[model samples]
Target: GAGVSQSPRYKVAKRGQDVALRCDPISGHVSLFWYQQALGQGPEFLTYFQNEAQLDKSGLPSDRFFAERPEGSVSTLKIQRTQQEDSAVYLCASSVLRVNTEAFFGQGTRLTVV
Candidate 1:
């Protein structure tokens, strides 16, 4: 894909359910980031992956949230035991360089916990 791609643009999960969102970044991109955005707010950093290694995950809210980029090109963000407070748009971005560089963002997966 020429741009970042995210699957199931919208997801509805019941409270306590688990949801997995997928992100396919531009091929060969070296940096991938996951962010959570609440309504009308800017994206909040969740995790960052440089290739297959996870360098930063301090922004993850709880143990229930996880992200991985196994082969480096594609990544997944999983939320377990979803709560109503977890409802938000999960954004994925990729850049050729490290943090602070220009990045391309996916449309995001809007998860609604009801």
Candidate 2:
């Protein structure tokens, strides 16, 4: 019954450095989603994966953002050439699959680019 978790609850980066954040979803979860939440804004979907297959990635801001789930369980989101505009709470969620399900969120990896 492990819940989702993210590392480095906080991160501060330079204006153009790359950073990789990690996410560990609940065991046995088949669907995982990544979202970016700006200050006072609702979480916006960044990408989704079912098992090891990436099902959607339309919300990724730009080519500078990338994500992957190779083993169907653990995943990572990498941001390249970080910008002040990229500063936000990166959240990871997971649910059972194929229907309406509740998504559990982590404390989030808060990235700040200065």
Would you estimate the TM-scores of all the predictions? 0.98, 0.97
> Could you tell me the TM-score of candidate 1?
0.98
- Residue pairs clashing in model 1 are none
Worst 10 residues of 1 by lDDT: 93-102
| TM-score of model 2 (CA atoms) | 0.97
lDDT of 2 by residue, 1-114 (tens): 477999989999999999999999999899999999999999999999999999899999999999999999999999999999999999999889835878888889999999
Question: For candidate 2, what is the lDDT?
Answer: 0.94
Cα deviation of 55 in candidate 2 (Å)?
0.9
